[model samples]
Target: MEPLVEENKKLKEAMNRSEKNIQRAHRERDLVESNARDLEYQKVVLSEHLATVKEQLRSKSEQLATASTQLKDASEQLEKLQKVFEEKKVLDCVEPETAPQPDGRPPRPDIIVKRCKTAWESFKSFNRDVVVTDATHALAVVQSHYPATDLEVIGGGYAKGLSEAKTQRLEDEVEDTAKKLAGDTDLFGETNGSGEA
Candidate 1:
């Protein structure tokens, strides 16, 4: 009986240890599952953040591409303007000397003044033409990039502002030219034999 009782006591102790180990395993499994859920949540958040960052980067890249295209267009236009300027310089160097005065005499003051006025007016016209040409080219570029419907959708204020700015610039240029030619005293006072202002 003592031996059986001792054996029974040993069995009970073994059972308690087994129960404790099972409880410990259950707790460890729950902890592992909770940690796994947390890791999943963090992964979701990081993925969302990464997506947002990628979208922003894409947007920036598109903007940069647009800016680069505009810059390239502007550079091309500048080159064209420079070429035109070079041509104008060459034309100036080769400008015909006022018709030799009849009888080899110096040209009359009136004739000289008239030629100067004509030249000045031509210069002003040329400047205006260049501006108009540049504006036209820019408009063409914009039109090429956007549809007619898109252009129509553009704000009226933007178009108005552009025209107003252009007009203002032209007026300023004319004023400057007038001021410069003002020194001639008679340049604007008389017409070049063509009877045109």
Candidate 2:
């Protein structure tokens, strides 16, 4: 009877160890399943994002191509106009004395202003609805008014709705905020006199 009781005690101990191992295996399996579910969710989200980005990229590429073509056409028109203007500007080539010509003196400020106004009017007459052409003409006028000067242009691009512009602005603001958070402003430079954060 004593020997049988000792054998029973050993059997109980083995059973207890087996139960613990089963519980441990179940926990491991549950953990693996949870990780797999999370990975699947992430994959779905990433695939959706990729599709959206590809569509946007395609649209932007088309827009850029169109803008490039418009710029090329505008440049060609400008060149042709310049040729015609120079040809018409020259007086009679036969006699130097009788040649009616512009005085070689430098143009005054008022004269430059008048030329700019005339150019603006011509561009408007050509196509006021065409924004790229309009902007190019405006820039040309500015450059003609300030010859031999490098100018800075800002906030000029595709004609878009206010909502799209606002969305882009918000995205830019978010990007800027992220960069500010990651970087030290002191390392780059100081703030303006306006005391903005």
Candidate 3:
């Protein structure tokens, strides 16, 4: 009878060890599942972030293209204006006194005065056409191309809304984590089962 009792004690010890191993394996499985869920959630969040960044990059590329075109157009207009000024300079020079009409005598005073008046009128017209009108148009184009931006007006409301949403999400996640922890603690406490094998 004494030998039988000793064998029974050894069997009970083995059973307790097997139960402990099973419980440990269950805990390891639960941990693995939790890690898998966390990895899946992170993947989804990163994918969404990547998509948003792509959209922003596309928008910025479009804006850069438009700005480049405007700058090219403005440069072309300026080059044309420079050519006009060069032509005007050539026109402004004297015509070598008309060669005295090929008669070896001084030209008539009335004719000389008329020529001077015509040249002055031409210069006035050129100034109005090239200097005033074209300059005004170029100024307008430049102003339109680089329009002013007000950050406060553009981002105030949107930034505020985004901040509030982020804060709310953080609070909710913290609350959920706290609840999960409390539940896990309760489960562990119940499974401990009086601290005896």
TM-score: model 1 vs. ground truth: 0.53
Q: Judging by TM-score against the true structure, name the best candidate.
A: 1
Tens digits of per-residue lDDT for model 2, 1-197: 99999999999999999999999999999999999999999999999999999997775544333333334344555667656655644332322223233787543344444565567557544543344444354445435644532333122333344366564554453454333322332322465544344
Question: Which regions of candidate 2 are displaced past 4 Å?
Answer: 91-197
Clashing pairs in 1: none
lDDT of 1 by residue, 1-197 (tens): 99999999999999999999999999999999999999999999999999999997765443333333333334455677667666656444454456656787875444555576577557656655654454444344445644342432222223333465564554454444333332233334475554445
Using Cα atoms with residue i matched to residue i, what is each candidate's TM-score against the true structure? 0.53, 0.48, 0.50
lDDT leader? 1
lDDT string for model 3 (145-181, tens) is 5455332232222223446566445445445433332
Worst 10 residues of 2 by lDDT: 90-99
The regions of model 1 sitting more than 4 angstroms off are 100-197
Task: Assess candidate 2 and give its TM-score to the true structure.
Answer: 0.48
lDDT, residue 33, model 3: 100
Which window of ten consecutive residues has the lowest lDDT sum in model 1? 149-158
Best to worst by TM-score, what's the order?
1, 3, 2
